[model samples]
Target chain A: MTDQASGSIHSFYVHTLGTPGTESLFWLCATLAVFGLGMRLQIRLGRAPWANPVLFSIILIAAALFVTETPYATYFQSVHIINFLLGPATVALAIPLADSIRLVTKSLPTMTLALLAGSVTSVVSGIALVLLFGGSHEVALSMAPKAVTTPIAIAITSQIGGSPALTAAFAILGGIIAAMIGETTLRRLGITDWRAHGLAAGIAGSGIAAAQVAQRDPVGAAFAALGIGLNGLVTAILVPVILHFLPG
Target chain B: MPEAFFTLLVFQLIGTAAQAALNLPVPGPVIGMFLLAALLIWRKSRASRREAHSPLSPDSEPGTSAASPALAALSRTLIACLGLLFVPAGVGIITELPVLSANALPIAVALFGSTILGLMVTALVMHRATTGGAAPEKLPDTGGQVL
Candidate 1:
């Protein structure tokens, strides 16, 4: 009787795991739990510059799926409710963007010129470097928008015939790299102005580097917010226009 | 809070509609961002105008000049979690692992090299423009110290 009871309990567990609703709930909880742990680990690490929670969560969750022999499509489908919020969250960026307009308008010309230079360099250098290394045209295309925020980068990549998934990974990786080296590099280069530091962080690193800058100074935070919004707009417009003119 | 969320969703819907209608290259949410920004600026200007004309009027509330309190709160919450929103897509990288591994060298080099190059270029350009080609001015409080 005890053996039968144990066998029946095991069957119940298998049945629930196979059910669609339970599967979705299980993945959702697992993703959130892992992300929370990533956040906790970052804090425990004393907020080390390289201890990025998003990067941590992605690796852990990906490993979990891989070990379970789960296809990415099922995992993505299960957690898509979180994914859907990306659209509205992006729209919500306008609040901070609007809040910083007054402060940013003071040096509009300087910011605009810097943004244009940085935006162009980010795209051109990415593609040029990839091709110089014998990377394919498709790979080069994916590299074009690596500096912009992930949401915008994904859209731009899809528009330009690149792999959106590849671009997303590249964009996040670029942000992490920027966050790691941005401050030291800027200081070494003698860029002392907080606004300049913030702009460079925002443009090259997008949101990730900007968050790091924000932790240091409120003034830098405002300018970083400006950098993110304006750079997104500038790159969004510039990439397509550049691609339009280039011979394909 | 619900109302504010609905407001954001409405703006997103409008943006999506515009993108579909125009077949524009830009994404809908981005267009929504621009529109919402314009609306906030307009509201701010109108509020200041009201204050100028009727200083004693009760209609001229201070915090409501731009975004409403609820909307601002909601936006802040969303932006704070913005990093989390990208994780799912980033995880999609697993799907492209073979491609990534195949071209890891170029990908890594280009990502790091271009980011550093872009950072330096932007910083230099902004520093030059702001300082009028003079020596870079140190931050007053920090005294050139970067934290």
Candidate 2:
């Protein structure tokens, strides 16, 4: 298609955003719909990680895309509307952060340092791990930004000559897996203090842990969110340098 | 879920629109939060100054309300978003099942190592800061310190 034609908008009655014969719309809607359905199904059955609402939505959407033979690129394009919402939603989190201004003000310096340390460690080591496992330089670079928020990770991944798409997925997966067994992990380590537990959760779980911490301990959540933000920054700056130290 | 979803949706819309209209660079939630914070800060400053100079006062300190309605509202919002927060993370987990499930053990070790490294660094820095600082005596205790 020509540039002019590509930029033109089209929605033939039941359009797929800009594309045609796309099951993107179906998968997208089903993602939200099946979430409700899954929760109900969960109540009827049980809350298995396999059938958790979020995982369920992913499954439903994945299946839709797979069965309908929809491409990930197409799915991302159609879902860009929701993705755009993510930006605002992230900004809105500042609301809680602001509300806990008193709490934030108290631990400002400590939180920054902690977040910086955690972020730098995660990203640097992630690169080291991939390289150690015999991953290509591109793959190692891609994995380097997996501990930060998606936007930041995507940005850093691109900067480091890695695949943004891969990093985004890895970032989310790392976050979810941390959250899934976060509490159990803490318990096994013999850390029972609420603050420690909550803080650890936020660092590991990213936004999800931050959300959980916001309810009980906004400070910890703030730490986690700050960690997410800083991790992206540090990873973006350090991953390339860190990679240089590794054997080529 | 419906009630929580609706509440978050409305607030998110309000937040997003406010962010867009204001031409803020950050996320809508961050903008909405800043707006909310500005209001609170204004109220706090005005109350503190008034309390400091007032000849007569309703309470010992105007800024100190034991059970303010605003805090309650914020609390409610935080609680409502708890479950919703997991949605994104869970979706992410499913997406990386092949990688995570395949190398669960190594990943677990990494998690522990990183957390320990973080905690030790945090404790040292916090302690050094405390010992070195000579300014305000009543610095805020960061309720949670997760290294």
- Give the candidate number with the greatest TM-score: 1
Q: What TM-score against the true fold does each predicted structure earn?
A: 0.82, 0.63
DockQ metric for all predictions: 0.50, 0.17
Pairs of colliding residues, candidate 2: A88-B28, A91-B27, A91-B29, A91-B30, A92-B28, A92-B29, A92-B30, A95-B33, A106-B140
True contacts kept of each: 0.68, 0.16
- Clash count for each candidate, listed in order shown: 0, 9
Total clashing pairs in model 1: 0
Worst-scoring 10-residue span by lDDT in model 2 chain B? B138-147
How far off is model 2, as Cα RMSD? 9.2
For model 1, the superposed segments whose C-alpha errors exceed 4 Å read: A1-18, A150-161, A187-198, A207-233, A236-248, B54-65, B133-147
- Candidate 1 C-alpha lDDT tens digits along A130-226: 9888888999999999898776788888988999888887887888788778877887777767788778988998877776665565456556766
lDDT digits (tens) for residues B32-62 of candidate 1: 8778877988887787777777757666443
Give one digit per residue, the lDDT tens place, for model 2 in B1-147.
444344345655766797578753334454444454455566765776788787775543423432245443544554434434444333444455576556555455444444444443433444445345554343233324322
